[model samples]
Target: MSGQLFVIGLGPGNASQVTPEASHAVAEAEFFFGYGPYVDRLELRPDQTRIASDNREELSRANAALQRAAEGAKVAVVSGGDPGVFAMAAAVCEAIEKGPVEWRDIDLTIIPGVTAMLAVAARIGAPLGHDFCTISLSDNLKPWAVIERRLEAAASAGFVIALYNPISKARPWQLGSAFEILRRHLPGDTPVIFGRAAGRPDERIEIVKLEQADPAKADMATCVMIGSPETSIVERAHKPPLVYTPRFSTESSQ
Candidate 1:
């Protein structure tokens, strides 16, 4: 009667982004777990038991989910955006690695979904056309010094940044700190997008200059995208803001 544990990704905000695999995984689950905000994203049947909590308690919640699975409850541990990308997958893995639950034979799977980085990239018209990398500015998991080194490396390497977990109530200055470091490599005119709750009802996309990317307007639900040096802000006469990053073919060598 051993049950399977699924780290299901719910995508950004809308139920429309939910993958068929993820949907099927949830449909088969007897129990579910995820962040409080993302729990509201689903329309599950009444029989499915759900565990919801804030980001601060994500690890504890995930551990409890695994424990439930070990106790023979079919389970799904949910996460918004992509589970493997700055979400609950790693946390679940780490918890399992720590041997908190003595059961080592439990079934575990990581289901992928569309992330906010790709969603925002689509909204801004291929700012990720070339090379790019994603990094979270939060120092809670990793050292701030290590994150700074990554930011500097990404900047010098000309990799466009898809910054997750940019700012929150407690870590208000994290984004600003990374931006200050990136500005040294990227020009101040580079396009920076503030995407709030991407794919949700209150979703907002603000295109601001690098110098004016205000961290005050950001929170855990937000994803801040900073483009590379070649990233262009092309404005058509009537169309909305369009971001274009040159590909190898598009770039003309002198």
Candidate 2:
């Protein structure tokens, strides 16, 4: 008898942000498999076993978790933020598609949690209140040219853009290049938000203009939001400004 497998998202580095559904899944799982830091977020009981690997070993981790589940172990594959959003949920799905026939037969459940972009948006205001799209700035899985094209297209189309994996040691130049691409289509005064470790104790949220947006301000933990032309900032006395995109668009009036 094959056991169950749960793909769970832990939310954006905050215990409070983790959904009840995800907590239930975590409690039910006997074995957990995930990247090192994400697995570290779990406060597992003595009976629960954790198997951690490097961040880049997603496929191998998924296969190992599936194998355990096939052998009747209640397994959980974990990711930070939403599992489906550029995370381990897709990795597990990819493994299932190309993995053994039995792997597909294993009972699977995906538990959702708050992603980074949502957390970041909440910290400031609703930049994602209007039509928007997310793009990963990392070029490991796809070409940099494709990223550039998407950035340009999204900007030109007036979509509020949320950029994940904005910077890393290996790909230091990608975020700068992404900013350059957006500049061609967006005005120099467009508001750009750099939200780092949002909802965590060490959280930092900064807003800047598109022309002055510094890529060096970001790390892998940051979620950068580039506002559309319609996005606005409302200033308050002695308080941080609220950044948002109006629900109504001027283009719609035409």
Candidate 3:
């Protein structure tokens, strides 16, 4: 009797953003495995055990969780945002693929949660209202040239771009380089949003133009959204501006 493995997304820092399904899954889990901060988010009963590892150790964490599950323990692996979005879900699947045959026998359930891009988009207006694509700026798994090429391709295609893992202490220059690439493809006046820790107590959302965007505004916690050429902003009296991309494109008018 192989045990069950639940891959859960805890959502962006806010408790309210956590889905009920995820909550239920957490309750049913006897063992939890995840990054330290993400696992700490859960209010597990004393009986439940948490095994936390470094955020960068995704594969190792997945293997450990699978090993426990194969031992007939109901285990849960948690991610801060959507587990499927550059998170633990993929790692677990990869582990199962290369792991022992018994690892594949464990029943797996994936519970979704609000990701950073969605949370950030909701904070302002609908910057993602139109065509959009997300790209992670972290070059840890991929090469920097690959990231730059994708940024250029996404920008040239006029897709609203949401960047994850935008800037970290270790890789500070990449975000600035990304902005330079965007400036070549996007308009100087295009809206760029820097949403940090969306839905959390220390949340900060800043909107700027492409030319004015400073890389210093972002950190590892920030989700950077660069609007398409078709995106627009609506100004309000004594209120923050609302930014949105029109639903209909110029080609649609034809």
Candidate 4:
């Protein structure tokens, strides 16, 4: 009897953010398949199998997990943030379609969790409160020229940009290029917030002038939030601790 397969979301970085249902799913699974760093977060359970590796091995790892499930092992394919939100859920779904795995009987569930996009938006007050669009600046899976076109369109249309996969160890200039596209259509003083290792150790969240967003501070773990003209930072206690971009205000009509 092929057992159930779960695609569970682990949330950003904090274990505390893990839902009780997610913990239960993890405990019940005979195998936990996830990114290498995510697997390290859970305390080692001897009876539970772990399939973890670098991002390059994700396809293979996902295939192995599906194979195990086909063989009737209860498997949990884990991802940081909502599995369906720029995570491994789609991989598991696509692999099942192409592989020999029998999905007809294998119960598959995608459990949702807090995504970095929403968290970063909250930290910056409400840049996302208005109409916004999300785009990944990475070219590894998608072409760079396509990304440039989309960036241009989004900026021209006045949509706040939530850029994922903004930068990493190898592709450093992607974000800079994206910024350049935005600068052509967006105001230079527009607010941009960079969230580094958000909710994790070495966490650093800072707001900077749009022109000053450094690519060096980013990695695969970071999420970049670019505000529309409406975003503004407010002062708090002797410091500016807040930002907000209202969807619409009478002030903009003048």
TM-score of each: 0.92, 0.98, 0.98, 0.92
Q: What's the ranking of the predictions by lDDT, best on top?
A: 3, 2, 1, 4
lDDT digits (tens) for residues 1-254 of candidate 2 = 99999999999999999999999999999999999999999999999999999999999999999999999999999999999999999999999999999888999999988999999999998999899999999888998889988998999999999999999999899899999999999999999999999999999999999999999999999999999999999999999999999998987634
Assess candidate 3 and give its lDDT: 0.96
Pairs in steric clash, model 1:
none
lDDT of candidate model 4 versus the reference: 0.81
Q: What is the C-alpha lDDT profile of model 4 across 1-254, one tens digit per residue?
A: 78889999988878888889888888888888888888877775889878787876667777888878888889988888778877788888788887773665688888888778877766556768778888978787789999999999988777888898988778888888888888888888888888766677777888888878777767878888888777777768976568777868433433
List ranges where model 4 is wrong by over 4 Å: 249-254
**Candidate 3 RMSD to the real structure:** 1.2
Candidate 1 lDDT over 135-183, as tens digits, reads 9888888999999999999998888899988987778888888889988
Which residue runs does candidate 1 get wrong by more than 4 Å? 100-102, 249-254
Tens digits of per-residue lDDT for model 3, 51-133: 99999999999999999999999999999999999999999999999999988889999999999999999999999999999
Better of 2 and 4 by TM-score: 2
Task: Point out the worst 10-residue segment of candidate 4 by lDDT.
Answer: 245-254
Could you give me the TM-score of model 3 versus the true structure? 0.98
Question: Residue 25 deviation, candidate 3, in Å?
Answer: 0.3
Candidates 3 and 4: which is better by lDDT?
3
Give residue 27's error in model 1 in angstroms.
Answer: 0.8
